[model samples]
Target: MSINLEQIDELRKRANVSYEDAKNALEQNEGNLIKSLIYLEKQNKIKPDEKPCNDNTFFKNVKSLIKKGNETKLIIKKNDNVVLNICVTLAVIIAISAAPIVIVGLILAIITNHKIRIVKKNNEDSQVNKIFDKVSVVVNKVTTKINEELKTE
Candidate 1:
């Protein structure tokens, strides 16, 4: 039996099967949509229906990212001495829960000549550390200028 592209596409969308699989199933089932679905199900070609806006997949991706973040450490140092060290996931949680305090603490850390570093698992350097370093340099320059102006007043 001959099957049109529309039938194959409809079956593919409904069963989440590939184009060839859908076309084969439709042809084998005499171009009947319901029978094609059943044929695909029997062949184990049909997968669990995943909607376009799938929340389960979204949550799974978020969980994976958080796991990676927990494996990575955020380190704050001053004078080559470790001042604070915590997992990135926990730091994010704390920052979210206390945004103002986190901002003030970060500003103070920069003002006090502290270094912010991100260390991945296996002690690999993170690219985020470069951004932190640049920001710290800019903030230090501004603070120093402000202090000089205050002293001259």
Candidate 2:
């Protein structure tokens, strides 16, 4: 088969090889682009492209997120005293493993006027803390109603 300049130029750009090598690979592979790449690879003229986001990269990103979570803290305070302090990651594990217990504890804390705070390592504000603030407002209203009912009874 006859080789054309376009085919040679395309191969050269793809393989990052000289004009002569591209033309030769194209000629040997009968102008097939995929086969020319394989031929150049077999001859060690071009290196294979690395994936931008492979398994290793994914795992690295997960590790980084976990690390950041560990650096953040979940704090429960009662009467201006810290009652419970734990890493955000461990708190999540506990909350997932014992969801009922976590819910009960949160309710009791809310009833007892304990404060829940998510503090980051750098003391920066988090949207999660804002969520907690909103939940606290709702729980406080419910608890106040319950207290009034108990008093009435």
Candidate lDDT values, in order: 0.92, 0.88
Tell me the tens digit of each residue's lDDT in model 2 across 60-97.
99899899989999999988999999999999899999
Please provide TM-scores, in order, for all candidate models, with all chains considered together: 0.61, 0.63
- Residue-wise lDDT of candidate 1 within 1-153, one digit each (tens)? 678898988998899999999988988889999999999999998998765664688888998999999999989999999999999999999999999999999989988889999999999998988999999899999999999999999
- Once fitted onto the true fold, the runs of candidate 1 whose alpha carbons sit more than 4 angstroms away are 1-55
Model 2: worst 10 consecutive residues (lDDT sum): 47-56
Cα error, residue 94 of model 1, in Å, equals: 0.5
Model 2 segments beyond 4 Å from truth? Answer: 1-55
Q: How close is candidate 2 to the true structure, as a TM-score?
A: 0.63
* lDDT accuracy of residue 148 in candidate 2: 100
Give model 2's clash tally: 0
